[model samples]
Target: MGHVFRTEQQALALDSLSRFLKAEVEPLYWHDYRDTFVPKEKLLPVTQQLAEFGLVSGVVSEEYGGLGADWLTNAMLFEEVAFTSCDLALLVLINSFGAYMLEKLASEALLERYLPGLVNGSRFVSIAISEPDVGSNVVEIKARARSTGENYVLSGEKTWISNGAYSDVLICTCRTSDEPRGGLTHFLLDRSEHPYEVQNIKKVALNSQSTAQVFLPEIVVPAHNMLGEKGEGLRNTLALFERSRVFVALCAVGIARRALHEAVHYAQERVQRGKKIAGHQLISAMLAEMATQVDAARLLCYRAAQMIEADLSAEMEAAMAKYFACEAAVKVTRQAVQIHGGNGVTTDFMVEKLAREALILPIPEGTSQIQQLIIGRALTGVNAL
Candidate 1:
């Protein structure tokens, strides 16, 4: 229960990553091309360079060819990535989470086949957990898997899957029985072997990241591909999500930080009434609020990360962090746009893109309303769902 939000070594790591982002990512942001999806040509090299820095699998265990860093370090790295581009950070997050789950739960044979490539960034993976009907109700997911001795046949559709269109592998959750939440099971699906279909989803925000709806028609997965024990998929996936929620919270902090920085720069240079706009009390108040919120959100995110690292049940903490951080990001980004005046609505200024991207943080992983329910359930011991 000790505080895990100390500066110490994490400060050094944050400084290093910040420097890397400034050098490698900031200059690449061009306002001319405001595409919804990141150009693959630009994404690949940056990801490969990040892989070289061991940022992709910083949380994976050393036994799985990773740095074996703790959650605090992992959060720091994720925040840095988010500062550069939320889209790129999201792509890395999807792949990292997939790899972490595989390493933690997959059989040795499965690990040997996928973990190294995944850690090295040679192979990317996506998780298919949200079905069209399931949405936030993990227990209501209708995807089914039938066992056939040596192989399991999976049939389901996953909507809004991150990195679905380009992932080399997929970790899909399906129901294997009718036993409430305990009936769910997870499968490691190799796209090369299973002929699945992926349809790209176009969205107004997070354009640089690929989202898709995946179709599985009798996809055959080997028995060894099963993650953890049968009927434990719901529990296992929830655990993974708890960790992921903290990471996403850090991303929210990063997004808000970047937007705040841009707004501050713009405020100082923009003039009105023959003076710098930043000199005005109203604009100065907005910037001050943005800075305070960013700091508070970052601290909350780090607290959740520290709890996870300390082997604590972080359900409430994760929900609080995710909720507060994302909500704060939305507020700060909107204020950033307002501070920029007329330039805020135009694509020429990066604040417009930042504002658009901020819209996705509250919805993904879990919605803000869902987080409230989670925290409510924890505090009152009532199953609101």
Candidate 2:
């Protein structure tokens, strides 16, 4: 029912995307992505195809190559794509993520230099914000950049960066001073400069996508590379974060829906005690709960997205959406696994992969605990952490 509030154009766009993903993309994701990343050779062709169709920034002005669509349209597209492949969904979103920020904060010359390639899928982008010691605490980031008249020298490390290993341009956060607030600056760095090292990490889940640690030691970027006003990186990033968490919530909603659908399909056919398992009261109750939670999560994500489109403050709304949707996904996927019995853990069933992917949804953008802290502060006007 995500289409409940959508316009006719929005409905048509989402419908078109859904048919394309299911017909052309889902098989590749389910098959090629079983053991490893959908190979770059296999993934890029499809990604470039979608970029030509306007998956970049649907909310931006048409002059910037965006469709002048709404945020809800973009979120709907991503959510539907996530139902097919969370890995591809992530790449789709992150492709334009750093580029959109550049569009917002980069100098006109810089944007002219990079935005087209970024928007059209020729250039790869990554956002470097978290450090080994710092996740949600932006004020404690240890990466440092110092102005050197012509350029700024950067030194620090970032971990858990998606696309870090392959980024052409990286938007990196650095400490410009020792102050807890207003000391941070974001620098747009060219990774080909050889100022940093990236090592792709191996993880138990989401292995079909890239995750890496980035090390920057004395890397220098042009003075104009600073994004947004100096000393305002945290504020800018927080603004981005509020919206990003909602997209992450969409990922959860997608996974939850897919998992719920799979469970229902399985229950209808699997027989136990001379009857289909779906006919059993306890099994039916689990299915009922899963369906209810997935829709609820979807509603929460759409509510947060609508607030973002309205240009309203959504810090608390985003936190609520992220926390509820991700937890809902985890619960739904767990039930799916239980319903599938031993088949759930095997590679033979897609539910196994869905379960692993679901486990990852609550960690990024902000941990559920961090979201709770944000919501708590909003409600009580006191910092709990």
Top of the candidates by lDDT: 1
Clashes of each: 3, 0
Q: What is the lDDT of every predicted structure here?
A: 0.85, 0.84
The TM-score, computed over Cα atoms with residue i paired to residue i, of candidate 2 is 0.96
lDDT of 2 by residue, 280-378 (tens): 999999999999898888888888888988999999999999999999999999999999999988888888888888999889999999999999999
- The model with the greatest TM-score is 2
Residue pairs with colliding backbones in model 2 are none
Lowest summed lDDT window (length 10), candidate 1: 29-38
The CA lDDT at 216 in model 1 is: 90
Q: Cα lDDT of model 2 overall?
A: 0.84
Expressed as tens digits, the lDDT of each residue in 182-287 for candidate 1 is 9999898888998779998988787667899999988888888899899999999899989999878888888899999899999989999999999999999999
Give the poorly placed runs of model 1, Cα more than 4 Å off.
1-9, 27-33, 39-42
- The alpha-carbon lDDT assigned to residue 279 of candidate 1 equals 98
